[model samples]
Target: MSLSTEHLLGIKYLNKQDIDLIFKTADHFKAVINRPIKKVPSLRDITIANLFFENSTRTKLSFELAEKRLSADVINFSASQSSVKKGETLIDTVNNILAMKVDIVVMRHPNVGAGVFLSKHVDAKIINAGDGTHEHPTQALLDSYSIREKLGSVKGKKIVIVGDVLHSRVALSNIFALQLQGAKVKVCGPTTLIPKHITSLGVEVETNLKKALEWCDVANVLRVQNERMAINYFPSTREYTQLFGINQEILDNLGKKIVIMHPGPINRGVEITSDVADSDQSIILNQVENGVAVRMAVIYLLAQQIKR
Candidate 1:
């Protein structure tokens, strides 16, 4: 089955069937994107408005590229340069944009539930790029898609997400996605960086990086979200690195090959090292590549549901 919802709001709202449909659709787009002529005519008549309230590199570029590849007319709106700087409310701003006949709205806002809030008020279909610390559904979709591409299957695979879970939308979304696909999920990092009651999602928390690495089939490392931290959560970056950093030494210590994954904008020596990120086992780049196709699948599916 395809996505039943009008908005790609969060992974928590999705079931295993939704995820499977996205991956299956992505499989076709993945093949199409790899071809010499990558553009598709499926969304040629559709228009997408990318509204980003937060600064981003990978997600923004990936979405724009995916929309372009799907042959959709795209408009990008950054809050920093928009009328939002003049105290314009989000609904007013988006409604103004939608007045131009945009069919779909993909947004990244710093406020949690911003997408959900927009969906309730807007006529255009909403896609949450990343909404505060709530969730990044498409990122999790591409992440799981990349994992399945690499490790062959997600069912029963052990995956540990390491880093700032307290402020990570990626972590929450990933837990929902991975667990839905029947993967065993774990979180490892400094205790302060992990939120209380995350275990209610059915993942264990391991404070020790070594033990966590030893236990998982894939190590999905996360970067310290310094911008999201209100105050000092840990003593220092150096101390945190000393305790949880993944380097060649750690990789060598692992007796078997374990796939390493990072979302993006990686800290060189903090949660993961340069050597480890560039290692063969690291599917970081593949995740970035798969992001385009996965997003295309999402946009295509959602575009089909649009009345326009």
Candidate 2:
């Protein structure tokens, strides 16, 4: 099955078939990346522009490496150093880049619906790296990919997402992707940080960390998004950590092996401890390693739709 859309705006826009196709494609790229010489000429003649309107380290580096592996001509753009700093509109900045003969546009913007908005006006294919509190489609895709790699299949697995759900693009995207692939999902966090309507997405909610950890096949930990919080949701960092933090003690108490995941820029002692993050049960590094292949699958599949 082929992707039904040209742009990957969000997981909300994808179906089970689309996800399966991406996974199947990613499997091949994963093998390719493992070889000594990892470059592929699938997108040899294509040009890609990565426009990040927000600060990023992992996502930016991951996409660039993925594009390079696929042999696509890549141009990187940061909003801080661009015409956006001079009051130029998003559309104008993108159009100027596209005029340079770019074939695909991958962007992470501070505004929600930024990818969707650009897809309406731009001629090139749009990939949503991320958007504000909206969705991070590729991250979710790689996450599922990592889970499948570790556990053999995503269907029927129990997964719990912990921390900052209301403000996390990763949580929203993962919920959609996991549920689509038949994984049971749960969100655990402080009441204020967990959205009231999160259950509408067909996932259970839990405030107790111990219960959530015991009930899941995997616990996907998230960092506290201090940048997104306009006002104090939870009282203090110490209180939040004491209440919800995952450490060696918590894992040892569980008495069974369950996968641990964290989308990075981890808060060492806050959300997760250094020991747990580096433990045998942790697939945190695997998630980062799989990101390139998953992104390559997204870019390669979309490039198939772009006429050379």
Against the true structure, candidate 1 reaches a TM-score of: 0.99
Leading candidate by lDDT: 2
For candidate 1, write residues 1-308 as lDDT tens digits.
Answer: 55878889999888888888899999999999999999989998898999999999999999999999999999999999989999999999999999998999999999999999999998988999999999999999999999999989999999999999999999999999999999999999999999999989888999999999999999999999999888999999999999999998998998989999999999998889899999998999999999999999999988888665
Model 2 alpha-carbon miss at residue 144, Å: 0.5
Q: List the residue pairs that clash in candidate 1.
A: none
Candidate 1 segments exceeding 4 Å error: none
Residue-level error in angstroms, candidate 1, position 149: 0.3
Q: Which 10 successive residues of model 2 have the least lDDT summed?
A: 78-87
lDDT assessment of candidate 1: 0.93
